[model samples]
Target: MTAHSPSLTPAFWDASIARAEKDSGVKVKQVVAPSTGRDGYAKQLQASGQFPDLLQSITPSQFTDGGLLKPYDQSWIDQNFLLPQGNAIKGKVYVPPTNSQIIPLVFYNKSLFVKVGAKVPTTWQQFLDVNAKLKSAGITPLELGGNDPFAAAMPLTGALSVDVLGKNPQWIQQRHAGKVKFTDADVVTAATKMRTLVEKGYFEQGALNVSYADSIKNFNAGKAAMYPMGSWYLGSIPKDQWNNIGVFPWPSDDGSVVVPFSVGGSMAIASKAKDPAGATKFAQKWSLDPKNLKALIESDGAFPMLKNKTLADYHVKVSPAFTESYTYVTKTNTKVSSMGWATNDEALPGTGNDDFYAAAQALFNSGDVKGQMAKLDKSWDTATK
Candidate 1:
């Protein structure tokens, strides 16, 4: 079995493996994979003919296109999974998602907001007004980590959530069907919004040099008024600072809530496993195991993807920050899959995600929105072919 490390800690894997061994009588060996650039390593293993029986945190199509994965039983998936066919390829479910996470959630420092006399903004214009106030008061409006290219893309993800997906929930599908391009009016609008933030000096100085871990530290220390990140940021907050933090979905144009989320981490079975049946059994058991789900929530603040399950169902103590963000999104009932980090059927094809990240980094540095959008279109066309 392969697992993403650091985020999905070693203890989490140990607990899940212990449960699978006890329940299925199958011994599982774990291999650690980096959270970023995971697909490159998986592909290397595939080329060496040593791909593991079970894989986590990998893009499904990278393996599905090569006929390397075994499809799950649709009936079983339908019975247990909230997103039963999320990562399906041509109507075949290859990967089963384990949880869900809202990306581009704006987590703000409550004390800093109060200090700057800024209220939580519900509309895009109001959000900018808050930022202007923070800037005028000698506080950085936002915290960003651009050195981790994926981290650099979060602000653009928030913009896309409002300017693109909020307008048309099927934007990704439309791009896949060649009905839209990154240079289209809506997409360009999103890019322009991202550029405006940079040009206005909203983000902290040297953000492009900060790593993801360091960004979390800086945010906790109150160097910035807000940090736009995933809901996973909940678990990273220091216990002492929990009461100082609050969260809101990325603001929309008309003040209607639009929370952009995606299936968190998914697992897939290799088609060439020595014991296909045993592998399937272990995958099924591990995915829905209460022990594993509890660990995921406590460690990463991930929402379980199992049907009829709530964060409270785990019976674990979480900070009020988590409860506030979770309750807000659920009550609004306006969740949409984030196109920037999507992993299911809405995922970008081939090298599209990597290209998007690179393009986003360039946009951050140069503020050349149109050039970056054109680059994305070219990259998309090449990747699809």
Candidate 2:
């Protein structure tokens, strides 16, 4: 109800708030966020006083490489934290994302599949086959929100066909890295398949323009059978529609297998925090401490990553398929890349989101495949430089 940044409100802060006040030598104070979005949030911070005990959810480049973060106090971490390595970074912790929600799978209605006498898809070809049947039956096979390019890019996630055809997630990353040519068969073919989905009306009408918020609403409203999203969704969508919710990995060509998903995207403490110890304490509490976890879930319906029993029991309604989906992702042999969308270099280049989106928009909108990619190569070349 308050105007604070939704990000800043994570219950974990309750711990740090307590610690900061007890020490009382320092106060972690901040104005709630702007009415506007991200850019305004950053500008608001830049315009203010000396750094507070913490700056929640800031980019690593600003707080880390820039010497803005004070390396985490390993002592507190050793006592209170549990995480995979490298999370500590060079030193200071900042903000770490803890609870998560489930991402959705684009599933076919089994009733519909049976009526049409079509098998639910297992491989890439099978998925397409199901789509064809759905079209003939006059129930749209998939719902897409093209109104927002961010949402539009989401469906391609299920096409593990690219990974299947290309052979693995590693191959995709290598190619994205310039280590493997973008022209390689795996990347190219994957691009082609995604483009095909667009051509086939696999997504909802006017999808190119759909806002990310509306895209999910449309899916749960039964506008689409499957949506590729995070497990965190379990906490947010309505209970009535909960029964219809089912999950599968972004399916591999054979819907049976999955590319293991790495649990990435947790938060870190800011090196810049005036109260590094307090921030560290908060991050840990925010992660799994009982009081904070309950606050987050009951208030926001966020998913817990800790496997803490208190949180576990609270999530029973949504855990089965949701937890398993995460297991399938982590089950793979591959190590998730250290970063992707999380990286500053990828996101914060000179022209910022504007310049990057211009390229992405061009690629997604271009009707001709070859022309689109050639343009993509040119855009990446410029953007990366």
Candidate 3:
């Protein structure tokens, strides 16, 4: 009955738990994990050997590979989960997405577009044209949270990956399989595209030092024309300026690419659940029930993955920007995870993630497209090996 911090709890969790317990007549106790780091939580789980019946915020890979979770039934994933990458890892449905995530979108100030006399761009060339117009009008064309390494890489990789790796959606798996290299010409093109943006002064001043919150503040204050982030950002916009908000898919060379879909939202059931049957029922309701899923999506500004479910199904008032991003998700069939998803040690180094973020920081700051990529390739090879 233990869980992640209440602050980080998903919107639908408490209600779902209450409903599940009422239906099943099982009294559940909620234990809060210590207010410590992720690894500390894992260590605590191990030392206590009391893995919560319903695990939250942990990926399937982390739990399954660690021998802490039971592999989920394939039928459960098939009938209940609308996973972006399908519902299996290594041919087993160990973990499926808790909710779909629409990432790497460019949210813009519609008024700024009007002032600069630019339409929402659909092609890479048009995107550059719009950037020029924004700059000419004395507006920062892009507001990036560069001080936060992952934030800096989100839009860069999102746009660049589509242009460079769009032809191969499974490029990450391929790279891991030793069938491709990060030093490919297209990969360099993608990395260099970001350098080109810096060279053109399209980004806001001191972007290299700005935090995500700072970038959001700058964008909302009308200091920038475009802010590229995930759909989750919709709720953070100030109500007074909400009407001026709009969204566009990141433009690509031929307009054939779409935003890469990622599924970071997941919950797993521990193998050592005290009441296995009850835990299974709760997990199913939390992930599969259309009503609960809808709440999660609407409340968190995530893309819905329920069968035949669309944004129209949720009748709540939502920002136009959210609707536009969902439309993009529905229209585009091509999707992918960021590169680090494939690289094992791909998170921030000390936090049990990896070194990719730091390497990406080098790429952005050094503008040494080739040199940085070589370093990245070496790191990836070592990690995958």
The TM-scores, one per candidate, come to: 0.91, 0.73, 0.89
Identify the superior model by TM-score, candidate 1 or candidate 2. 1
Per-residue alpha-carbon lDDT of candidate 1 for residues 1-385, written as tens digits (9 for 90 to 100): 4655664677767877888878887777887766676778787888988898888767787778788999999998899877676556677877776677888889999998999888999998999999999999999999998889888888888888766888888888888789999999778988788788888989999888989988999999999999999888888888898799999889988999888877754568999988999988888887777667776676787877787777767777777788887775446556677866777667776677777778767877786788898888888788778
Better of 1 and 2 by lDDT: 1
Where is the poorest 10-residue window by lDDT in model 1?
A: 326-335
Candidate 3 wrongly placed segments (more than 4 Å): 1-13, 34-40, 84-87, 289-299, 312-315, 341-354
C-alpha lDDT of all candidate models, in order = 0.81, 0.49, 0.67
Pairs of colliding residues, candidate 1: none
Arrange candidates, best TM-score first: 1, 3, 2
Q: Quick one: best TM-score, which candidate?
A: 1
- Please provide, for model 2 over 1-385, each residue's C-alpha lDDT reduced to its tens digit, 9 standing for 90 to 100: 0134353353545554565455444444544444345334553554574344444444545445545555444554444433322233433344343444322244333455565687656677877777787777777677656556544554443342236322653543443477754455555566567677767877667766777788678766766665655444545566665455655545455445643222222335445566666666555544444444454454444444453244355544443444444454334433222112223222323333343234334445665555554554565567566
- The C-alpha stretches of model 2 lying farther than 4 A from their native spots are 1-27, 35-49, 73-94, 97-120, 157-177, 254-256, 259-268, 290-303, 307-326, 329-340, 343-365
Candidate 3 total steric clashes: 3
CA RMSD of all predictions: 2.4, 4.9, 3.1
Give the C-alpha miss distance for residue 183 in model 2, angstroms: 3.6
Count backbone overlaps in model 1. 0
